[model samples]
Target: MPHNPISNVQHDVMHSLYMNHHNWLYTWIRRRLDNQFDAADLTQDTFLRIHAKQNVDLINEPKAYLATIAKGLVSHFYRRKSLEQTYLEYLAKQPENLAPSTENQFIILQTLEAIDALLNTLPGHVKEVFLMSQLEGKKYQQIADEMTLSLATVKRYMKQAYVHCFVLMENDFFE
Candidate 1:
């Protein structure tokens, strides 16, 4: 079978891209994530995403595309970091600190796992609003405006969501 010249060029470009920058991708992610294991995972995920997209001819610069994918990984990492920080701040206010003991890092990890589960249980709009307000530092009125909802509706949603999150934390039950 004869391959078209354009197809051959694309294949050569993609192959060279894979060869030249693959190892550097992990370093790029590790710099942002500060964890080699997670960096390897993210680097693999980046290439997997590029492969899944099959965007050979469309991307003018392969390095730029890799950088964009790495940036996305960084953004996701920071988003989770912010979520964990918010959860920790919430936990700090509780009367009981379950992870207070020196060897109770396991307990803290478990508590964070439960909080993550509970966060997923929230309604879409409510969750977005909560994230905007608490994580992104948006004001209530700002969230209402951004969501195109009445201020009272925003307030009600936030209150209900907060109460649910608080109760879940208080009970130490995520289900």
Candidate 2:
């Protein structure tokens, strides 16, 4: 017997899910995740879960489906945050190279969170461009030539990355 219409839809959805929606899904995941690694991992997990489903349809409301996936990702984030806090508390109780003052610890955590939030908002390449220029201290022309992107494109991407990080910072993460 041939596959039913729902099965056919499921096949189609599975085939195209990652390919067609990768960027959108990444953006969605990033909004809720702290950093590039977490965002990338969760985005990959979202697709993996979809793939693992026995059968699913081409969802009439892909946006809604995507939102549901994001919620799960957020829950994962909270769980991770709790574990990290526990690890940090344990580390505090251990002998260390240096003890962190409460203010310094707060600053470090805020910086990490800000970095995570910024990374989530940025596109992969844009984030790369910004990192290459800022973290590596490369010139814009150098970044453009290295990435084989146009100078204007590199500048635009950097500008977008800056705006994203700036907005996150302005939210008073440092305060």
Candidate 3:
């Protein structure tokens, strides 16, 4: 096998970390999720994400680092499931002919996840106005009344949301 000194060292460190703590991390996640299958998957994801960072040697507290990564993965797992369920519910209510193909569901879920991540970066009121207008089909005046804000403020929030989305799209960062 071809050897790159940096990658070889990283692999060894990652392997050592995994061998030492996989069981503990898996058990911790399993208890939280109450499912061995998901726990195992997330445990693997946590390690893979860490491995991908190529900085295994820099960690001083290996277990602590692994635990932090594992916890974040578990949270992401739940968030993804919630997003999928919400998308499914929305699709279920759509007219039969308007439903996307089964193959498109995965892509749509990924897109929604990306969009949700993007929205999470916005201020609370900005995100609220964007979702109310785009998802709930609310008028700006309605959002203003519900949010107890002036109509101009609501419009500005919507404008900010749209501009942010447009910039991300322009850079192909959202794709």
lDDT of each: 0.79, 0.77, 0.91
Model 1 Cα lDDT, one tens digit per residue, 1-175:
8879877776776777778888888888898888988888888888778766766667777778899988977786676677667766866886774536634644665566566668778998888888899879999999989999999988998998899899887885854
**Could you tell me the C-alpha RMSD of candidate 1 in Å?**
9.3
Question: In model 3, what lDDT does residue 64 have?
Answer: 91
**Maximum-lDDT candidate:** 3
Model 3, backbone clash pairs (residues 3+ apart or across chains), number: 0
Model 2 misplacement above 4 A: 1-11, 95-175
Candidate 2 residues 1-175, lDDT tens each? 7869877777777767767887888887777775778888888887777767745463677667767977877785785597569648866897777767778876776666656565756899999999899879999999999999999999999889888777767886545
- How many residue pairs collide in each prediction? 0, 1, 0
Model 3, 59-87: lDDT tens digits are 99988998898888888899999999999
Highest-TM-score candidate: 3
- Score residue 20 of candidate 1 by CA lDDT: 85
